[model samples]
Target: MSSETTAASMSTTTASQNPADPVLAGLKTQEAHPVSKKLRYADIGINLSDPVFRGNYHGKQSHEDDFTHVLRRALEAGCEKLMVTGSDLKQSTYAVQIAKDHPGLCYATVGVHPCSAKQFDSYRGGPSALLSAIGELAKRSKASGHTVAFGEIGLDYDRLFLTPKDQQLKYFEAQLDLAVEIQLPLFLHSRAASEDFERLVSARLPQLPKKGLVHSFTGSVEEMKRIVEMGLDVGVNGCSMKTEENIEVVRQIPLDRLQIETDGPWCEMRPSHASAKFLKDAPPLPKAVKKERFSPGFMVKGRNESATIPHVAYAIAKIKDISVEEVCEATWNNSIKMFGLGEVSK
Candidate 1:
């Protein structure tokens, strides 16, 4: 079915169930603002393969899978293209399959997350074999246009409890080599490991024509400038705008070098965040209900979805004092240029 048809159908279904439902309210708000109709967005990082989308939270299923509904809402909200992050071998494989299943509407990235770096040692054929397998997946998937970048790979010093610093460094470098060899743009992550992250990525920057993105960036202005100096793009999400410093860093980021993502199932925009105040004029989001009371067209509370990506753009525009349309257009082009996702009609 067409996206408009799907959105209309969902809206009708929700309106019939409850006149005061948040989904219907949101749809009405969207019509009034018409931001979704006037703009387009490309969420460069979304954990679509995360089990949360399947209603599995903290290892228990609270409701039926609403992945399809999630996509519909995203499209309806003007987030027309989404990149599914692949943080491990298995998730990478699933991400590629999801891109194939959804075609142009979705794309995939393949890499082992630094936190999961230890998995490299335990793979059936060991670290080298694991690296080779990821290489193969990227090649095959890229050939078919299902995969766009190599990532979810980088350093996370704050989470050393998950994977030791040594392991994260070793595998991150290994994956960097794989990304260089695969010749795809990168989708990266970094947490309190700026020094090492910059050194490693800068060393390999010459070999990567498409460069890459440092996603969920919440670093200091110096760190942001250094990443931009390395010729890498920066991706912002809710986490990137949580604090006053984060807002300032985002405000100073060169618009041409910025991309946006939802980082769904995590990094949601909370009411207490510094960005919340800027969102006063932003688009209204669909109402969220608790998981136990989950309805087909409503968001599950606390679980972020790509549908909320417009809010990210609005916040950025507000922080930077630019028009929301400019933020949306620039990010849409920046993401497509960096990842080569091809043309997406507005």
Candidate 2:
């Protein structure tokens, strides 16, 4: 696989840390990736609360200013709303704060990431205590009109080093139960544990909220079908288009059941995936988009940003032989339906 495709893998690491990652190195010098202008979209999952995206860059020291910069860029590119994801308690708190501060521009998810599930066992009062705390945060976020879902939570056997399977299950079920109890939609993750993931989700399907999403999905066609059959939406991003096989998987997903996201600073689409030759009727790159950096280190030339979601629409349109408008409209409506974005204003 190309370095760009590999760099799109979901992780908390920056491209600079991985010397071999060309995508990161290219960001410093590469031309900005093309994006469609006036494409109103919503990112189902983005970690705006992550420090790396907020840290000092371009002589800026204030994280709030850094966030505003990113959000403004996204607004200029047509990102209507951003769901800031929280994988653990600390990050969840940050997510809620960002959403609360921004109002309609941002929303927060409350739950522990599967990889960080070990924190439940290690913390005082164990899993129950963590759930209670997350519940409280969810309450506050909801009261502030910010919290939209319960997640970044699910099974991740692929990262066994981060949390054992047993502990992951314990935490996953607890959060699933909590989500159902609170009557909130879910923002879930699953990797290398499809069987258990399906089983667990199937077992809880009835109690869970009426709508939910499988964020950053990179699963088999069979798994995708199962998820759709269970009445859940599937999220697609740069990672979802890593290989031709992955592209084929995305092509099969019903547009209505699919939602698009940048999962920014990660999951960037490979250049080859959305080259000028393939982008039919795509508009010229915006001057500000080209001038902006996706993060403190990665320029718009390389790193993924919520603003670049149009590229995701472009790539999917190419693979599915559909128009970018169709992809954008369907995903936009799916996000609104699944997250009930309309209710936030009330």
Candidate 3:
């Protein structure tokens, strides 16, 4: 099918007309909800390597793998480019392979997540070997244009129970040094550890030209301003828009410095979210069924996919009172500028 047709089909809702008199209610529905144009989107942070996409949930195989179908849906929805997030060495390897399988359409990032910091200390080959493996994979994949950034790395005090403060701190700094040596931009994370996250990232910002983004940002407006002032971009996902305060901070984010992500299948937008009100006029998404009842073309319910990225843009547009096209264009450019994902087809 043509791109235009694919875009139009993204919204499955159709106007039902009365055969006797087809002019009033049907026309009103059409007018109130017109078909949206094909606006391009780049999902800058998606965990495509997550086992959930492959039908594994909580260590159990619940259904058949539908990874390719998810990618197809994302492309049809105008999310033409996706950056598969790599939280650690194993997942980073998987992410790189996914990128290789779908060049241009997909990309990858490589680094250890702060929550999984203890993996560094427990690796069979030792901490330095694990770090070296990540570095080698990043360097190789980057040279081939498969890997664009060097993270999913940073501080996360909220999940210190998973990895203590000292370990998280030590490895976060170690990974930052690796990013500096590799000379790649960052894909950072921070949750209630802004002070140290900022201190460490800022200390190295002078040497990193591309800088980086704090993906899935949920900090206060003042915290956001500090990040922007430090020359870093802010990435927004459903988790970033859960409340009124989050929406306000997103509104304050500079369009040029803003990027969008799914961070899925983790940050799915829900009905109770503050951002949901803005989506009243947004295009309807494709039909979804529970994961157990999954089919080839239907989205797995409760499992976030890149195809819903437009909903994110729609919410931001409504919050900022701007056109969705504006949001798409500015964010597409910002992502390309930051990650060098190359030109995207309009």
Estimated TM-score for each candidate: 0.90, 0.81, 0.89
For model 2, residues 126-214, the per-residue Cα lDDT tens digits are: 76787899999887777667888999899998899999999999889888888887878889999989888888878887886556899
Tell me the whole-model lDDT of each prediction, alpha carbons only. 0.86, 0.74, 0.86
Error of model 1, residue 202, in angstroms: 0.6
Query: RMSD for each model, in Å, please?
Result: 6.4, 9.7, 9.2
Q: List, residue by residue over 175-245, the lDDT tens digit for candidate 3.
A: 99999999999999999999999999999999999999999999999999999999999999999999999
Model 2, residue 247: displacement in angstroms? Answer: 0.6
lDDT of 3: 0.86
Q: Provide the lDDT at 79 for model 3.
A: 78
- Ordered from best to worst TM-score, the candidate numbers read 1, 3, 2
Give candidate 3 regions above 4 Å deviation.
1-37, 344-346
Q: What would the C-alpha RMSD of candidate 3 be, to one decimal place?
A: 9.2
How close to the true structure is residue 218 of candidate 3, measured as C-alpha lDDT? 100
